[model samples]
Target chain A: MRSKIVLVLLLVLYGCSFFLRGEDPKLDLGDNVMEGVFFQGGYGMQWVHDTAAEFERAHPEITAYVWGNPRAWDQTRPRFLSGNPPDVFWGIHNINFWVNLHDGLVANLDSLMEAPAYGQEGVKFRDTFFDGTLEEGQFEGHQYFLPITYAISGIWYNKGMFDEHGWTEPETWDEFLALCETIKQTGGGVAPLTHQGKYPSYFGMIWRGLVYKLGGEQLMCDMDSLVPGAWSRPEILEACRLSRQLYERDYVLPGTSSFSHTEAQMIWIQGKAAMIPCGTWLASEMKNALPEDFDMRLMSVPGFRDGKGGIGAMEASAGPAFWIPVEAANPLAGMEYLRILLSRKMAANFLSTVGSVQPIKGSTEGVNVPPATQSALDRIAAAGGETFAFQFSGWYLELENEYRNALGALLNDDITPERFAARMEAMAERLRQDPDTIRFSRSPRGDGVAAL
Target chain B: MSLQNNGRVALLFVLPAFLFYLTFLIVPYALAFGVSFVKWRGVTLNMEYTGLGNFAKMIGDPFFWKSLYNTVFFTVLTGIIVPCMALYFAVAVTRKLVAGARFFRITFFFPNLISQVAIAVLWWFALNPEFGILSNFLRLFGFTDLPSWLGEPGWARAAIVAVKVWAAVGFYMVLYVSAIEGIPEDYYDACKIDGAGEWQSFRHVTLPLLSEMMKVTGVFLLLNGFGTFDVVRIMTDGGPDRATETLATYIYENAFELGKFGYATTIAMTLFLITFSLAMLSLWIQRRDSVEY
Candidate 1:
């Protein structure tokens, strides 16, 4: 009888612990005044949280919680689907992610922008941000998210190594090829270009560069729906031919398909590879992961000819944006907090600390940006280049998988370029037919292009 | 009164275990079945009744089919190779054929004690194509080139199977060793008295006795074959053209990576079905009367 009582007591204690552990209850504020903004964990997020706390102290009623990354997006989706998302949520520019979720789960920020409290701030914020960054946040003439950071994808090289060797950055595709030859002749045993070839997404990045060189920004806009004989077009064929040439010439790392992004980055840092095609994040990662003496520099990927820029030639901007959920306990409070964050002073602080380019005007000046990055930014601004859209964005999940698979097959020589294009067309066709796939206003209307 | 009291006591003793089985196993299984039929993106509260839509999609998905094929291939290879190797080692150890038999047994079993993830990382470095020990060694033998073992189609699958077999062999060997030791020494003595050769004794007496243990091991191996995930996940991540993808990894990718809960559950149901049927078939084949000796 005593043992049974002991067992019962233990069971009761175990059950009680389950209910005891969880997030603390949200603090209550009287009369719906400023409460706080919650953020997920990231290098950028830490800055946001710190800045948020300062803003709150200046205006005592407000408070903020900086949470860890929402690793359980699957577990959290049900709450989002129920229309009760967090008061402040993170947004990504990629299609079918946080920004698109705003279509159904979030309040239309456009409506919020029209409010008197928001109107002046909204217009000022809009003017300060780069046009391309702003354009990426708009869908169907309504802004769903605010672009927070701008990233440029390009070829990063060891500047010191180039200076010592008397080698200059290549200005054209032919020049780039010649540079590879020169490096090989000069007894640099390493490949000229290193990238994460195993991931099909990396291949898509190269394709984006080539496509931009061939047709400029318009090519990306019209990629989902191609005109008749698109695959057989001379420019597209040239892109494929050039890629194959690079492979045959052994200009890319041998066993390139085996290396992960991190592995490739390490190789580049160790001076094994002359150049690596990567994003602005590489600079910050290198600073943290490499020795202090590491001397890496970023450059816009070289052009295809004398004038046309290569793919990833200009800055590619995409990043997390802050949004207010409609079902928040204090929506007005959340909006006011966002306003504080978007202020020029706060934006500059974030940009400097996080190694990011803020989308606020005057935030770029006096900021401590690396010289190479500053140069790339200046070049993109000079060329009137806009945002580079991720090619697989705005497609169904299966369609994206198909593209990744096709690219993997292409890299392994399991499929020809013609077959790769055919497979992509097929995937696009499937997405067109799938009822769940979101259709943008600009989507192609008719069967002018045959379904693959 | 005595029989009835005994029956009540048996029921009382089983009640907790029965409740646990019902809650953890039966309830979740039923929930998963219900979930498999609906079109629910894991994140969204919204769900649509799709009946067999998810299953239908699974049948047509190339990745799904590829994963299933890989899983079967891995299972068959590991099931045959690991057990045979274990049995051979078991026989050798029991006969005291080698010096430091205990050391050999403990050393071989050491890998089984290490976490699968740790072992995978160790092997990954050892097999790294450019600077890895294996590739460097191969290059020394007049072979100037070698494929990345975990990064190519044929090789990735083979490497995954090899890792699984390596990790599993030791545990199964210990089982065989125990079973072999349990056999009465008198049987071998009798075989020698009858002028039976070593091979003849092993074929007749030892083989018959170990048959039951083999049946149990076979069933376990068959089930593990279908459910394998960690080694493959850590090693190849189902890449190099999805060559090393298995049903579990595919299901994980769908549910977590892609956020297609309905599709993932459907795949899981299919895996459970296959594993269940294979286990049942194995049990049927291995069924026999308990050995009296």
Candidate 2:
């Protein structure tokens, strides 16, 4: 039949179409060549390009190529699947570090960490980083990620406003509450505290700080490890109650829950609010929007008077982690590039250009940074052995989402602290029970930090 | 030419398009269906055959139920409201009941020309609680405490539906206009001679005459409502406690964000089936007695 002939012809043509499609052209990567793919986010790509150029200049025999965009991962993911990933990459939040590590796609950076520092005399590369910075990137006693930037989350306020009002930073929870009351009464329609309510994760740092203040770093580890009934602990409930008091007492900016992160920050910047909670990146992210007279400064979240982690305890973490693919063509060159990137000169350049701290110690020495960044550095220094960061949020995204939702509801006055705690515990229990969920156990390091 | 030769020629002409459809649509859909049966993390080739495990998970997941509920609510609400309002506007403009009918027709169809994402962003800014046009206008009327339109759970769902109707009513109005104009004028003349008023004429003659087009518009609106993604994605991002989370957004979150590729594919398969079944039901209902005037 004619129909049978047509069907046979179509099947043959479909088979021909497959044969007509040629194989993907292989890229010609020469000897000692390192390709870098970076995400061009708020910090931008100038620093990355400069670091690449420095690496090339140091090792003229090697060619270092760099390319990036805001959606660099969109292009890089396919390469990863094809086993032709870039030698080094940074600012990729799309790739799951745990999944990549489990699949052996991420390279262990132990050898790089044990190597000598790029320029520091007789210093191991690992010792060049600040304390508690590199710990987040390690797994099973081997480093798998290299955190390029260091950040500390705290309350940001205009130094000029504080000085004008003769308001000193609070050191204890009671003093913090008293200061909020004073600001509400005397500050002429200014709300005492505002947070990036659109992103409830911003408020998590405050609550985590409170948790550390109440029960020390071990409580945070227990919660992160999903220790049985950890969410029902008194310390977490108290932290939730204290955070909710800001909303219940109307000390928070009106309609803050509706504003985006930038919008909320602008509200604090425009002097409508006395203080805002944010990370050190606040300075750079809002650089162009800031008024000339704005003297942004940071302060660790105030602690309880009888707390375990002390008043000076703070939440600090290395951010925007960088990594080398396990199957990179020039893994050694990629390590070299990272080492050069963490050198004092480049770290200082990162500080000056990006208005954020690098994980490298002494990078801020003699470098003129924005007062807000300097304040973050000072806080990190003051915390000393007390700096702590929670691993649960980053480890379990479902838990993070539930926490954010509950926190948003609590801030919006739709739920009580008990209800919020119950919601979080339920989510934590689900994640702990779910065999498919990749749960990581964390133990408290001897020094007040949780090692994931 | 012989009838058999003519059929052969027609088959040859359809070959290119049929091949394209098979390659792009059929192949990918089949592949996705196969993937829905396995447990894969989306990044690598490591897959475990989980059989009905994903389906069991979907049945138990509260978020999946919430998204399905939202999707159904969105589809039904938009499906009913859009066509009714669009028909009203079309009749008004076509019958010259409203002044400046030509200008109104253009204005109604204006939103259809804008991309859905652009419209979402524009509405987002317009509905912002602080410094937004709506809030500022409300403030002028002594409404000191305006509700957060995009931030509250209840208001956010309502706002998304309202915006969807606003952006969609225009396109449907254009379709109805064409359908109305296509109806013969003799029927209206006959209705007028039979002592029928405007309402009676519309109820008897025009309504029956437009039934076929009504079926078409209903099906279109149903499809558009079921495929609601861009506007809600840009506006609420399924936020304010997963209030406006559509199946599409949840699919994206599961596949891309949470890396549950198999789970997301299962959700997509269910969505496709629901949309197809609803469309078929619509056709079945209308196929019984379609007016062909």
Candidate 3:
């Protein structure tokens, strides 16, 4: 009798295990069920959980199983090569992920953009966004992904400081330099401008702004096409010279090399610096870091003598995009979720919550945009400002690093402006020589042949 | 029959742990070696076998050389400074030369208990050139300007070493203290009876017996130095121009930041071989005959 009871209990336990391992009863989608379209959390996917819930409510046939940050591509790529990948991935850095698009790992969204449901919304979508946001997502005239947010790099200043000093905003290069001199003479002690010299991206912003101011939008655009010997040109030389002069005058903060972007911003907030070149995200971040009443203003980098000082180039770069992997268990459902995310309602919600500039058309109503940001938007619209050009997508990381190092050297007076220009030229020459090291098939004309 | 059954059960108990080691350790290491030969851009769906291309590339890579130099400099500095200071403190505590020995022990060991990330952040704040506590204190002494601790290349490397030593010396001090306590009191008593001074007793008797403990500490320090990453990354991110980069941080940046998986794995494999050989050599050299109790 004891042996029989043990046998019965063992059989029941084994039966329960099988029953528990069977399909989830909650998701009863019959034969049309789609799985694995939901992701819980990541750099840019915090909203996906809620978005997926809404998506599921609208489409009951689709079942989504959310996962973690798509196990960084270093780990995930091997799985992709082995024929398994996530249905959708979020938080992909724009420049690096462009390679995935070039390699055909992600679906081409051009056809989807043309479909009636997607096209009508997409055509209006293209027209509604700031001009350069979409360009960052495109390569060789085809779009692989849609930008969820657009980050524009510009100069942010403390209005209260400027006002307290009885100084007017400078409108030209001469005026800007004169303002720096005035600040110095008055013993402001604070730097006129603060930036992260250690980060190549921050220097890239200054370089792009200089290109725009000196040569105008067309010349800046030409530089990106690999115009041979472009850096050796007079305009580029003057920009380097001006940057060196600024450093010599101590116009920038001390120990800039040690500070990160956030640290530099903190200095500005604490009134240690008069100005900072940062992105639109700074407005929200500043609010969070300090009292809500702290006053700040955003404007373009001051321009040169020949150019309008307020007429600066703003960097409207690609932010983050979501991609549906080719090996996904349910590709269409993933794409549908993306579509919902790109919808006007979702765009407004994201903008309100995260202060991200949505790519969708029309202003986000009921979103409490900071007054300083609104003032910046107004300035840009009034000035007819041009968007800055990025030379190579993310593949230019090496080139950028070299340029930043040269700039840092120049800032420390370790290198001459002429030498800096020569180094910049050499970087272009190196890129031209080593096609494999800096490969971008989409832009074959980008072989140091274009001019700024 | 009963003894055989007991042996079988013991083997069964050990099987799970053995399987875990084989899966997690042995497999990943073998896979890392295999991946080192490929040219993979991490995110791409394709990989090409590059043979010895990556290893060859390391020869000319300035960043790799810079990182190696920094790692060696950091290791050498910490290896000498930490153990000496630890030994000094251990002697002081063991000899009862200082009052409140327990307080001193706890104070020295306190830093070791703090997470490296927290310590790095604390140092960063303290060293901030404009408003940091150290900077402010320096200014009060009429030194108006000082190089940023983690910004200038030379200073950055020095700061990294200093921070490592500060966080590490205490733990090693405790180790030395424990080892010194284990020495029989009779040796010291005999030395005193023989008219030997404290310093002479330490030099003649204490030093020789502590060789085993020194070897253990040295090996630990060497291995830890080779793998230094967190403090550098959090404090400097190998910056002010890659002046403070270590092998581990370099590998991470190449793999995650630059998307060069094959290149990063190649670096990791090189580091593994170098560190493994050095560790083995140290262990072999330190394998002295066990001293009689």
Top-TM-score structure, candidate number? 2
lDDT of 2 by residue, A1-452 (tens): 99999999999999999989875323454556888888887787788888988998899998888877777766677777777888888746555677667777889899999999988899999999987678788877788898878878888887888999999999898999999999999998989988877678888778888888998877888888888888878998899889989877889877677677888888888988998888888888888898887898899999977887768877888843789898898889988999998888899999888988888889988988787787887886787757888887767878888888888887777888889888888999999899877777887776776666
Give per-residue CA lDDT, model 1, range B1-293, as digits (tens): 79999999999999999999999999999999999999766545667889998888888877789999988999899989998999888887887878889998998899988999898887777767767788899889988768867667887788888888888888999999999999999999999999998789879987889988998999899888998888877777787767888999889888766667787999999999999988898788776565768
Q: Deviation in angstroms for A450 in model 3?
A: 12
* Native contacts matched by each model: 0.41, 0.30, 0.35
Off by over 4 Å in 3: A1-87, A92-95, A116-128, A197-200, A215-228, A231-237, A307-311, A364-369, A412-438, A441-452, B1-20, B43-45, B288-293
DockQ of each: 0.45, 0.42, 0.39
Candidate 3 local lDDT, B1-293, one digit each (tens): 69999999999999999999989999999988988998887655478898998998887687899889888888889999999999999999988879999899999999988999999999988877767788799888998768777767778888899899999989999999999999999999999999999899899888888988998898899889999999998888887667788999999888877778898999999988888998898889887565656
lDDT of 2 at B251: 93
Give the alpha carbon lDDT tens digit for every residue of B215-249 in model 2: 98888888887788999888888878888888999
Rank the models by lDDT, top first: 2, 3, 1
Whichever of 1 and 2 has more DockQ, that candidate is 1
lDDT minimum window of 10 residues, candidate 3 chain B: B284-293
Off by over 4 Å in 1: A1-45, A70-85, A91-95, A98-103, A112-123, A225-237, A306-315, A319-321, A382-387, A441-452, B2-9, B139-143, B194-201, B288-292
Q: What does DockQ come to for candidate 1?
A: 0.45
The candidate, 2 or 3, that scores higher on lDDT is 2
Could you give the candidate ranking by TM-score, starting with the highest? 2, 1, 3
* Model 1 C-alpha lDDT per residue in residues A117-230, reported as the tens digit of each score: 322343544455555455455656676666556777777887777887888877677888898887767836867777776566665666556765775544444564433344
Best by lDDT: 2
Off by over 4 Å in 2: A1-32, B1-5
